[model samples]
Target chain A: MLTGAETEVVLLSFQVAGWSVLVSVVPGILLGWLFARWHNPARALLQGLVMLPLVLPPVVTGYVLLWLLGRSGPLGSAWHSVTGGHIAYTTAACVIAAAIVGFPLMVEGIRLSVLGVDRRLEDVSRSLGRGRGATFLRVTLPLSLPGVVAGAVLSFARALGEFGATIVIAGNIEGQTRTIPVAVYTLLNAPGGEPGVMRLAGVSVAIALVALLVAFWLGARQRRRVSA
Target chain B: MIEMRTRHSVRGFTLDVHFESAGPVLGIFGASGSGKTTLLHCVAGLLKPRDARISVNTRMVCNRPGGTWVPPERRKCALVTQEPLLFPHLSTRGNLAYASGAKDALESDSGWKIVDVLRLKPLLDRNTASLSGGEKQRVALGRALLSKPEMLLLDEPTSSLDAELARDVLSLLLQVKLELKVPMLFVTHKAGELMALADDCVVLESGKVISQGAPVNVLSKPRAIGVANLVGVDNLLRLEVLRHDEAGGVTLLAMGADVALAAPLCASAPGKTVSVGLYADEVMLCLENPAGISARNALACDVTRISEMGHEVLVELKIGLQSLRARLTPSAAHELGLAQGTHVVALIKTSAIHMLG
Candidate 1:
């Protein structure tokens, strides 16, 4: 039985995580393919840069995001100039922070699966009169689809748990950016908030467990497809 | 018709090949690692050679060094590799219709003809992963044919199969050649397949074209020692069918002037040339025409050449205008005191002479 405030926090968390996955899906697939297929000396460096958020301290990542979207920052100023609006401390900022924190997991999952595909199959497709793009869409993408879906689900789970980035950039604003992790954090410092924190923490654990199981199942399916 | 001149080097292996063939089915013959597949890849536009000029059916597909470079998809050359690289996610029907225009091709009368030829009608709904090796290859061939390629590129398409299955596939390929009449560039190391399918042949040894001609001519008189070794037969002769003894179940072939060799019954008409292979080890050398021998033929001949290979000796005997090679142990050669220009009788059995195509 979640209180009204708790329900709002849970709902907002879903909205933010959902948006984060939606915004990152295309770029994640593109970067994942590049990481898997590109044969250049600089590819490793670019991949490392994209994967930085996965290993870096979340608080530090949040601070960097804050600087980039802060009023004085170039991007922040440019946004203000283009739309006469601000991007900081908003729901959009919450989505951006969560998406950034979860991106590396998504990309790595897709990259490994794409790499697992047999390149000879693509050659056969080409020889059968399918162009590169058509072959990718028909052969490579379908073969690696399970992995791509797993990556998206994993990122969504990661976004739901994102606390440090959301707190720093979007702040713990109620009903707007006060996601489950932020709400739990907020409740921890206040008196008579242990019950609320317990419920949110349980929900978070359940969501994480389900996400991991789905990812593993999808990963197994991908291995079977490639091996077959 | 196809013409190719290309050179490519990878790691330590180099592929330098040049040949022109007017073929309904041209066979590229070579042993493993001899650049047969590499040459096929180059022609299929799957591999980019360092210096190359390739034309198929009078249209230039590739000309490197600031010339036209057509991609593989547009080359109209469909390749069926040794392994059936079917799309794993798709069913057999789906894989058969995967090419750009294959869906429409599947509905065409010609498409049904291909399906019938490959015997793929029953396996259409089965998952690709569930098909056996032979079934998979049949589907692969059908898929390639459905693409309506200008020329088919087959890279040892039957090598992975068992002997019986290989023969079945080979016959199917023959049917494809005769009934479908699609131009093809078939690659294989099997001399029999080359002889049976190719209108013209190119023999490759270590990345170079050693010989090019009709299959029977090139294979019968191998230009290089390497080709002779690859062909694995000491004697490959093209002889005229002299006559057939139906009751005796044998056909007589003219080997040379006034000399005839009896072989197993064949359908070749009299006066037509037929290629036959005989292993050197199967020929026996005798100093005199021995009596009461159960062997079929004992021909008196003069030893023209004697070459020692390892523990054995190869004795080349001249009978009329033809030469037949016989293998003997060092002890046997020494015991018989065999030498060049020595007169001896070469014994051969009818069963040992294998009719090659």
Candidate 2:
């Protein structure tokens, strides 16, 4: 039922959210396990830094990303010196914005799940002549899969809804970085955009509901595993 | 062979345990919070000690002064804890296969023997999450064995189980120890398990070795205050089986040269010497040779020693050359006017005698 432009916007949103989740998942799992298992004093600092995006204002976070990736900024200058390409106000910048805003949610979900895994199981694995890495892959990772999946889905949903960060860093370029939320905002600004707004809003709600249902299912599975 | 001389202190509880056992299974016996589990963890390489010199099969695992320390996975001691923390995501077969990472090897002699010995073939394809507690433990044991460990470290592996289940698991462990001939470090609070499983034992009391030797020898004496009851044998009577009345369901046992008692029917043949375990509380002391009582055995004895325990008195009785201990309420002792050198009759029920092979 959607027009070609609306379909493109919808596909772009999925692409950006998918990429954002993909970029955050591996690092999120590693960070989550580290936070759950490591007891070093610096762990608190690392945890706080990881959680900063979750508590910080999204607009402020976007502004910081903008400065970091802007043409004159140090990183952006380095990027220009190497690849000779501007990252800010691009589709790549939109993905970065979505990833940054959604990373904390992903990490938090995975961390809690990793924490829920019994350490005795790891000890048993080690005693069975399995090294730390192998034990993690064979036992810890599989056991914490529910949490990992839930975290990824939640992060994808968060990435889909990301607005302020995308607006500031990616600049809502039509047909390029204009995701569902950005498209809705743009349509709202136009004189006769109420119908378009309702359509996109409904789609957004549908995606969020699906993500939430998936997360709930995964969480229930995790609880069953634990009880078992 | 297992050698561990370690000292680790945590929150003011200093654990200083030292022992060396070359026996097939060395039982570490202790109550809760007595550092038994901690000691096992040190041997398993799960806990780093403040200082340690540990060796397994003559190979040095950890030596603080020598600066040689082998990590857990390489320790070659497969630890099976109380709870079978099997990988919930894996099937029983998968868990077994995960240990050695060889499905074909498990189908081979050593691994197949483990599966067969643990009776896990039927449950192999079932998910670990679906197994019963005893079944889970069996799978855990099977998984540990699949690694072909040099030794097995069992930390109260059956403590969480009920008596029947615990016995079942213990019997399986016994089978493993006998069939595989794998040396084991069996840590337990159950006195019966320690006696049945270990050739040698080290009794820990508050992180210190109170006694270390054969379970029979070490447990015979009250190693520490309030330990005899915990040992499950307050009085051990070395009795010679004279005869068995199968029709009557009773066995006549001779203590030393003269003292005799009737015990419940046992499986031992005549003229065989067996150790009989009698709990102190079960031995009743009477002021006179009481008749008309259904109790089967009553022997006249001289009270050799009277030691006061919590709310009760442990009366050490000497009947001829054999010694017996009876726990009497303080009021009974007062009523009977009991003291060292007093003559009294020790009454015991025929079924109360437990034959210890």
Give the poorly placed runs of model 1, Cα more than 4 Å off.
Answer: B222-251, B254-260, B264-274, B278-357
Residue runs of model 2 more than 4 Å from their true location after superposition: B231-258, B262-275, B278-357
Clashes of each: 0, 0
Model 1 pairs whose backbones collide: none
The C-alpha local distance difference test score for the whole of candidate 2 amounts to 0.87
lDDT for every model? 0.90, 0.87
lDDT digits (tens) for residues B1-357 of candidate 2: 888899999888888988888878999888888889989898888988869999999999999856888999998889898998888788788888877554666988877888889999899878777789999999889888888888899999998898689999999988987888989999988776777789999889999898898877676555532464664435666778999999988898986576778898888899987777787888999889997999988899999999887888989999877888888889998899998899999999987887765
lDDT of 2 by residue, A1-228 (tens): 687889999999999999999989999999999999999999999999989988898888999998999999889889999998999999899999999989998998889899889999999889888899998888889989999999999999999999998999898888789999999999999999889889899999999999999999999999888777
Candidate 1 chain B minimal-lDDT segment of 10 residues: B224-233
Candidate 1, lDDT over the whole model: 0.90
DockQ of predicted candidate 2: 0.66
